[model samples]
Target: MLLLATGDVIAYSYAPGRPGFLSGAELLRALPPGAPGAPGTPGAIAVDVVAEDVMAEPSWDMSPSTMLELARRARSAILERGFDGVVITHGTDTLEETAYLVDLLAGRAAERGAIVLTGAVRSLDEPSSDGPRNLASSVVAAADGALRGAGAVVCVNDEVHAARWVAKVDATSVAAFSSAPFPVLGRVTGGRFERLSAPPPRPPVFAGDPASDVALIKTYPGIDPVLLTAVVDAGAQGVVLEGTGVGNVPVELFTTIAELTEWGIPVVVASRCRTSAAPLDEMRHGAGLATRVGAIGARGLAPSKARCALMVALGTGGIDAVRDWFRKL
Candidate 1:
């Protein structure tokens, strides 16, 4: 209650057709003249948390324009009003990324009050919408301290997920995000919090420059080394091969990647499908052994999140640190 909420409007094509528009100004203006429900709702105080438009602007970190203002207000609101928590409205395009970023940036204040991230599918103009519900639940979750630990959370379409694992997998479904490699921490059913699992200790996050030159290579039929070689020539600091099942790539492309590794660039081996990773157990020859030489394994991480981890690793001290960070995450 009396929670601080942050909102952003996406300015890019987040999915197939329509762009991910945060529409913060519109939502702020439509905030029910006050928090949802009757006046003086007991045990809950609600406040809209508005932040700047975080224009991801593509291949870069997107942050709301009102981010700093929101942060200042959040710290002030919590310390001054003795409120329960904070809720954020972010674009699904980079919502998870931003959520985890804020979680780390906010430090241990993460444990002090709930900081939940929520987003919408249709524009606010649509009917039978989920925006209001999602926003309300975030406040509810925060007020209930469902966001008290495990870093910032992305609460949407009745599902509560960790920011680190939440991604806009589906472009249009209300249930756009899925918490892969993790379980749903809770859900909103019948207007109340239904926690199925408590979050584990949040994984370590070493944020690298979002602009870092990193590319993920997904092996496919007729795969050619020319494309991968192009990425390496483009000055990619790292390469993530989204190889075939069990981390096998075109035998031809594998050699190219290996050659890139030999050139001192870090080549990370990951899988393109499912929760599988490069066959660390099969590091006997070919790509398997190439992984043995210097390739880092993304270990069950989705390609997007793996890319994030790799960027962070590249920004860190060195290769060993990067390897340890990946293993830990």
Candidate 2:
């Protein structure tokens, strides 16, 4: 019941080689010859699979909305293809963003089975290719039996992560893309799957408009309160603050946050470190300070993910409503 939504022939600003980039089709043709497997071979996991290419353009300047448009079409393709799960080959640059959008648009995440997103840090044409291994892992991960009922995830190399937490850590290493602050669900191995951590709760999410102006700001040492105060002044609908370890920020920033609360701008607090993450409702060091100061805990969400949640939540309703929605998601 798994489906593979393959990537388009898009090139990026950082792609290796020539003055420009090559198409995914062009790259695939350039790969070394390998022994092809028979259908449902004992050596392979017999995943109900399909390969649908998306994001054919090679530009790095796509917006979240444009990505959403592509995801929606891919989702439709998945449903039309009668797939219970999906895997996508996409540009690593926006893979995380696109994965989030696919989860949002699908709505039926559970019935859609495990949708895995994966791509190469190094392209296929390169001598040290990662695409074949990545694509194999993506296919295997997509049809993972234990992954049934789980939402979309990003599978690269041996590591598998929740789409909500997956981030690209190394630009050039074949072993790139790691899940921070959160644990990975599993890993692909020996044409089989192995579980690492429990699956996250993935409730169904309805699609919403994507043009909303939600922003993310990191709170660094000696960050002036004026910058945050100005963010509210600039009419930003909502802001997710990437705070320090365990969501801690300066108490003075809390005072500015109070001012922001009075102005009706929602500011969320998330930690800046990858190892230490934000807690949902519980007050840790930084989150408690912000909560005590009337700012909200981003609640188990990465700052970027929190920003996306805030944007969608605000578009659906006000801060109060958005807060409740975030809590449940």
Candidate 3:
């Protein structure tokens, strides 16, 4: 297994009043032999570590281009090293989105080597630091043979979550990650890993640049049409609208969508609600408006995921292909 560090594994210094960033090498050097085997297994599992200081910055200001590059790197390293799996240590902020992006970008080859995204809610300097244990659990999950096709998983606080379903629900708690409506893949118990089920097949990789232009606009009460117009004017290739219940927006927004589609800019409708989305059937009123205008429905994807998918779709295919892709999704 290969362990990659993005420096968030231990960003803060352990001692109070001392101001300095902890290096990835420092974190790795401090880890103990915490890797545990499956229950009744004889030997300790071994993990290969990447060189330190790979990621220049520990912050989460990673752009779409950088994220896509990292995902490609992970896939290449896994294949070249013939590693069973890979673990990435990232910052909690925006971790879920990064994980989901990787899940979509890492195609068939990556399915053979599962990718596990992990991070800590607290800095390593905190007295209640959970970084080491969480990192260990992530390694265990990545190394599990049964999770070969699980796409990308976020393993933290001992629970294993599918990258698509997992969200960072809390800003401060150690148990910040959760998968709702959809259950977790499994959890680590008594120093052993467990698998509930394999994740769905990895999404097809986009045959385009990772930094494809896409914009996300959240529909709010009294949202201005000019804002939507600005997206088109700004030359965004596609737009993701975070609509209200059942992925509906105001009537004017639907007209804007029609205009946008006419301009060859695809608009994907996604619900602002976190848990679920209603069907965008022709029978529904607000949803039907989108259908009348050829706007694609985001199905159950969150706005962020919708934005990511639209970026890929816009880069690789035309509006029809994008609509069909979302329809299948």
Cα lDDT, all candidates: 0.62, 0.64, 0.74
lDDT of 1 by residue, 1-329 (tens): 34333343312224457545544444444544445332334443544343334332331345333343444455444556665566667667777665655554444456678777787775555665677777766766766755676567889988888766666788778888997767998987755677887775565654443334678877688987888789878887778877755566666665776676677667777676665433454543444544655667776666666665676567665666666766666
Find the candidate with the highest TM-score and give its number.
3
Q: Which is better, 1 or 3, measured by TM-score?
A: 3
Q: Which stretches of candidate 3 lie over 4 Å from their true place?
A: 14-18, 36-42, 56-60, 275-279, 282-288
Error of 1 at 294 (Å): 2.1
Over 1-329, each residue of candidate 3 has an lDDT whose tens digit, in order, gives: 66667776455565767756566555665555545322222366655555334553544676777667667767776767676787878888878887888787777646687798888887776787888778778777877777777888899999999988888889888999888878889888766689886665467556666545789998888888888889778878899888887777777777788888888888888887763433465435434467677788776788888888787777667788787766666
Lowest lDDT 10-mer window, candidate 1? 4-13
Among all candidates shown, the one with the greatest lDDT: 3
lDDT of 3: 0.74
In model 3, which residue pairs have backbone atoms overlapping below 3 Å? none
